[model samples]
Target: MEENGLLNDWTNEHPLFDNGQGDKLSRKSIAAIVKKYAVKARCVNPAIIPEGISPHSMRHSKAMMLQDTGINLVYIRDFLGHSSVTTTEIYARIGTRQKLEAIEKTALSPEPGSLPIWQRNRGLLEMLENPRDVVFNYYL
Candidate 1:
């Protein structure tokens, strides 16, 4: 996997993450850090953000982006560690959002209408309707 660049394991020196440390990062602290950095960067250049963007938004955006790339829902569900597929489905809001967008884009989508055999030839229904024609066609 590493050779193919599919997956990489780098838990050894994660700054925010520690081994055997029960202190997980609190959401408030992360939000404050994100806000501080975002504010500082925007002060230098306001184009760094639009407005009201937070770390949680960025994380959700990343998850949605991953789901939009055709990754399996089951895999995403497992990655998020949901107790049930239904629970994992909450994280799949992005996928559903994309699906809704697609439906809107293809609101006037075309259909096959009918199969080739249905249009070109008689089937059991036609045969039952006209037994003589069916027998004559079969003989011919």
Candidate 2:
């Protein structure tokens, strides 16, 4: 850092990361370091990592990875620092693996002839509250 005209006396600077014995660097400096290494890595192996990879993009990938692991949407929302879950939902794409895992985890559907009690009744007075589960009886 000294050779690059950067400060080496971190004792006074409040940095997010420090070597404990070295000068502290601001967030901008940290990001610049990452950007520098990314450019170097890109030149070394152009196909290993994307050319445009950045700290923010790494955060996005982490959020998507959490969503792909079948984590609760609400948890993912908080993890990604979104003000609302709707925003986080934008990153939660249900890939084929998740879909298959969800299907496998669900309670096996009752046998064809052995429908649940509500299905046979079609529209019992008590079932009127929320019949969305009865898909077969609904036109939609």
Candidate 3:
């Protein structure tokens, strides 16, 4: 399994446990490696990463990135090797990133104390019918 002398051997280096059936890298060892790499990645990108991040979060983030671009859930499920599509659907949430981007792209900034003309008809009727109750009844 040698490829450019990077991995000279693909077999396990040591017995997994006293049972002597599994590979050298146990689940605990893989978990520790994942945690170590996660910490290293956080150190490199503190602004993008949040506290208490784990290895799974990276998978979730990748799925979310694809989801934001309107990628298919089935493709994402297969990419993540999920047994069920439902598991992958959890990563499709339109979180703060998409919300903020949409708002920044489409938000209309009205002048102070002035509604957009699109609402002028409604405002005019409200003003003429009941100006006093307009403040109490109008809800943004």
Candidate 4:
């Protein structure tokens, strides 16, 4: 929280990840450090870990995790410090399994309490006669 100025908190204005010598760790160095940790984790859990994980993939996973919780892409963009929303929108793209799961949630049935008008009114028969006008959507 303090490193990011989040929750209106502060832990000395010093850089959070600093080299032992005294200066802040550069972005390249941070990536290397993250990879080192990933390698350590991979050794402990070989079955769960992939061979070539990096900090960038970790960032992508974080963005996707936030999207999974239904956070808006605009907010995600800001949270990731992205200059454009398009950059953040990539995380919102759903996988095929996610799409299938979402589709499975819909209950397929006729509109509740709304009987087909054409069934009772002969005048409305044109709706059923015209294929273009006949909408078979059951999940509203």
Top candidate when judged by TM-score against the true structure: 4
Residue lDDT tens for model 2, 19-135: 455557766766788789888887888787776677777877777788877688899988888999999887776654554455446635667878544335545422343333443
The TM-scores of all predictions, comma-separated, are 0.49, 0.49, 0.48, 0.59
lDDT of 4 by residue, 1-140 (tens): 64556445353556665788657888789888877877888788876666666777778878877877777889989988999998888766653344444544652444778644334444334433443456554322
Clashing pairs in 4: none
Model 3 per-residue lDDT tens digits across residues 1-140: 35434354543554423224444665566667778877788788877556666657767889988988878889989999999999988977775456445544654767899854435557645643454456643332
Count: clashes, candidate 4: 0
- Residue-pair clash count for candidate 3: 0
Which of candidates 1 and 3 is the stronger one according to lDDT? 3
Error of 1 at 44 (Å): 2.6
lDDT at residue 106 of model 3 (Cα atoms): 59
Residue 101, model 2: Cα distance from true site in angstroms = 6.9
Worst 10 residues of 4 by lDDT: 122-131
